[model samples]
Target chain A: MDFKKKQTEANLKPGDRTVPERKIPVPHRDISERAQEMIAAPYNVFIDWNLNPPTKDDWSKIVTKVSESSAPAVNKLIEDLGLTVEQLQIGGVKCYRLTPENIPENHRKQLVIVAHGGAYVYAPGIGSVREAAMFAAFGGYTTISVDYSLSYENPFPGAIEDMIDVWRAILTEYDPRSVAMTGTSAGGGLIMATILKIKELGLGMPAAIAPSSPWADLTETGDSYKTNEWLDNILVSYSGYLGLAAKLYANGNDLSHPLLSPINGNLEGFPPTILTSGTRDLFLSNTVRSHRKLRRARVPAQLHIYEGISHSQLSFDPDLPETREAYGEIAAFFDQYLIW
Target chain B: MDFKKKQTEANLKPGDRTVPERKIPVPHRDISERAQEMIAAPYNVFIDWNLNPPTKDDWSKIVTKVSESSAPAVNKLIEDLGLTVEQLQIGGVKCYRLTPENIPENHRKQLVIVAHGGAYVYAPGIGSVREAAMFAAFGGYTTISVDYSLSYENPFPGAIEDMIDVWRAILTEYDPRSVAMTGTSAGGGLIMATILKIKELGLGMPAAIAPSSPWADLTETGDSYKTNEWLDNILVSYSGYLGLAAKLYANGNDLSHPLLSPINGNLEGFPPTILTSGTRDLFLSNTVRSHRKLRRARVPAQLHIYEGISHSQLSFDPDLPETREAYGEIAAFFDQYLIW
Candidate 1:
């Protein structure tokens, strides 16, 4: 058939913005072709949500399943990195410690307190271990990943208070200057909130900190909320999973409460910090805003935005060339402050 | 040191965008971090010019090294996926054919012609087998990859002539409707140029084509040339490496010639086509423009832009969710026309 005839026959409105009528005749393949394609690949690395957020009840079920078993992943990390995994009672709250077998002598005293991020309610115990183990393996740091209380069971102050509990315990043993904090997504927001809470409680701050793509804005006020809505798959739109998680965590409290939304917090005396995020990350604006805030406060901060990466991809494959550059940047930054 | 005092000591002009005077005191590692970051993940997956295009002597040396061994990669693919690899001489030009162990009976007659990208100089011999084997393994299609001549010794029409020579032989054996043409980077441009050449030679066109981030423009006239310059690690800027490759391939020929620079070509009667590129891809503008041209011609066209990814990341990892999605989209599109 001629090009014009095929065009009319297919009946595709080439310029139409609408989903073109499926006149393109494609034959379906066998089940085997579909089976061969499944390679244990996890779904979207970024969150995915359309215009409306999920109902409260729907989110509750989703949270439970994601939180259920991260143990398998934790065990894999332990075996892969030859790291020691131990549980510690931090101010009565339990936290996991992941220390690599070979910590290059100088990095011995420095411990990174990891607050794992899963929008506040998911990926608790094993999440902390898996994330912390990579930090240990990549940066050669002993780590304490705080398994803070979740918004699912305790809501609002529960997670922040638990983060404080672990922070208090760490400060009690390690010299304030010898310690540091790091987190991703909600865990990242917790890091900023803890910094504020520490100041409020008259506790000394750590020597340095790194918050990788923190969900610092509880409200969908950042530019990326709209620009990166669909670009970021896992967190499709700000008002979806993130908003649902925020409402559940806030549990009727003001979304902009300084502790609840770290973007609104007072960031004074924040330690020399390094932050990371990706361009397509839904929380890219959140991360960018936080970096601007730190810069405004005249805090020495380094922000590394990996091109074309999604949320938390910096920590995804420790061996990926970009991932190594990311953590290597953190290790170099910490060397100046925490090595003492 | 007190936080307030250390802040002054560090002397960070947070908002000052003057590259920060480098006083952050990062101990330089063995390759300046910048130097270490430059790897030819095929550079642009289609274009790689180190600093400057080589003189005749240098080009000869570089070509020999790259052509020396693609065998190991081909062997690995054969072992990994139960696929058969065979060499064929089409119109006296060498090409590689890859076929899956079991072709679905209905689709056995259809085949995909791959034009491998290597700035027209690299990845010849086993490059075809490694890339084509994956399509056979994943998409269940027999793939024939043309190992076209490069500009190092044979410039301008050398590669395009070789591609047409192979295409002519393939068309003689298989019905034009039974074949689909696909390429990446330079090969993508080759597909467009060849289509124009095919029309000139009065050969029947293939049913469809898919070009993954084609180096469409031979000149630096695209918007992304400036926007995605430093952002795209591999193809840092159009003026740098791609420019050199374009110059070498054009060999002082008219760049605006439709056959030499496909972006300038008439896309009328073009086959149903799909194009892929990343947001950070330097050729993003090239891909977007080509899609526009096809759409203007009312040729059915689909473009998939992977978020924040650099050039040609679609084929970088066979197992990445995005890569799978990229290929899946093509296979589905091809099935629409090729199955009949």
Candidate 2:
């Protein structure tokens, strides 16, 4: 029996007194019949609001809270996805390894190393660092995210050193050219710095890198710090929030030191890079400038800027079309450069 | 052996001539010292631009293209997540079941049935229908999404009849009160109609219902269809695109027929409802009005509106914090009432 037709027939009877008028005086609405032709219509996609810059103290508090951010619920999320979660001590540094349950034999050697971002603080352990690598694993890689020490105590080069050590240890099992490195925000910058450090120490580089809205310059020096200031919700401005992160991580060192801010370092031989940012990201210039520098240095680089998004917001949601597009691009880039 | 200290000392040599000036003339940037105050600051969170509605034919083309939208990559996404994908025929109707690889014994009877949105036209197959049920599976239920007949061919009573048949078959296997129904856009509206039909037929009501920005009023009769016209990127305006979906599905039926538009249906016993929308959703009024009707009828109902988002954008991104928060809430709601 077609219950739908029966229901509709029951609801409407011509000239029947029982079909009541709308109970409330409904607000006036435009009818679809009046939809005039849109001549090259320009549409609004998302909220485009701005904010007043945060006070230094306010900025510090915000940065501190972010650094201390933890996702207690993420382990369950990883488990629910059925990925194998393992905690490994590499050269005395903590790293969480997420291996997809099954894959083609040829895809086995491919690995994606992630450095979790918390402005070089926060995300202090394996639990907090899971969100960053979840995307890479979901992108179909055996992913391992380094749980580096934060600047709250370790400070400056300490986080970078931890990542370098983890990388050095993992390189023994996986070919350098078969691996990819990725990070976001401070973690993004850390990947750049770690590459430079590895290069300086004469170590091999990964095949590719995907850095999402990297904080390349830590000295509050990019144009985005002004133009897109307060437009980005996460990192409001370099001067307010990021500068605090810069100082906390720098530990009173010169802000432009190559090891602390990779934007100031040489870019001549960097890995094939896929960089990302949003129009409203405070680190927009960091991405644009890095892409230009890599190109000028003859390093192959691709930049993907998402419209109407803030720093790393796309990275947070794996289910978003943009997130899939973003990570899918990264995966394809790796597939091109690596043996996968 | 302090690698961090050694790395920092080597990078910084005070008064060294090798430190280069910035390669690019960066724009004037703001400084942290001048963050005066944000006294009574109003934050802009979304894009609020307006546009003239598209011509009827142009609108229809766009809507048709969107309705025919399919996620070709979804099956891979599911397999990568390690969820078991199974297809079943229930009373000659097609359904795709995505069961978590390792569900606790107690949770097996609990199921979330999904009706995917595409104005009743999109997500055509097992692959296309994955997005609708991903959240339910993430909520730790054995999830199954119906492959209901599309309006493109089946139209009107055809799709709803298929749903009723599938629901009836599934109900025979699992308790109705342990099931929760969900959908978005046309799919969302379908769930409402299905629940009403089930109630009319004296079937036990599901534990809860979560409809994301449902198109409850297909009549172009809601206030948001006018106010949010051109503001919502996907829908833009009801007159432009959605009215096409309405007409195609109505198949000569009156727009206000309760089966065609569930807002006209009874809300007195809608099961516990959690309705979702965004400030930019064209269906904001549908969700709001539905919530209001359920409350007036003394039915337990809750509404969630994401700030600066438009129509199912939260649903589109699984990685989005809003997506997690949304499904997490649904899962929790189901947990409270369902015996499992």
As a whole number from 0 to 100, the lDDT of residue A76 in candidate 2 is 59
TM-score list, all predictions = 0.48, 0.44
The digit string of per-residue lDDT tens for model 1 on A1-340 reads 8532332233222111111111111111111222112111222322323223355556566655555555776688688888988888889998888888889888887888988888886776665566788888888989988888877677888888888888777777889898888888888888988888888999878999898888887887654454444334345455455677788899999998988887788786899887777645667667766765675576777655544344675665555665666677678778888855
Worst 10 residues of 2 chain A by lDDT: A35-44
**What is the iRMS for every candidate structure?**
23.2, 28.8
- Best candidate, TM-score-wise? 1
Which DockQ values do the candidates obtain, in the order shown? 0.02, 0.03
The alpha-carbon deviation from the true structure for residue A35 of candidate 1, after best TM-score superposition, in angstroms, is 46
lDDT measured at residue B177 in model 2 versus the true structure, 0 to 100: 76
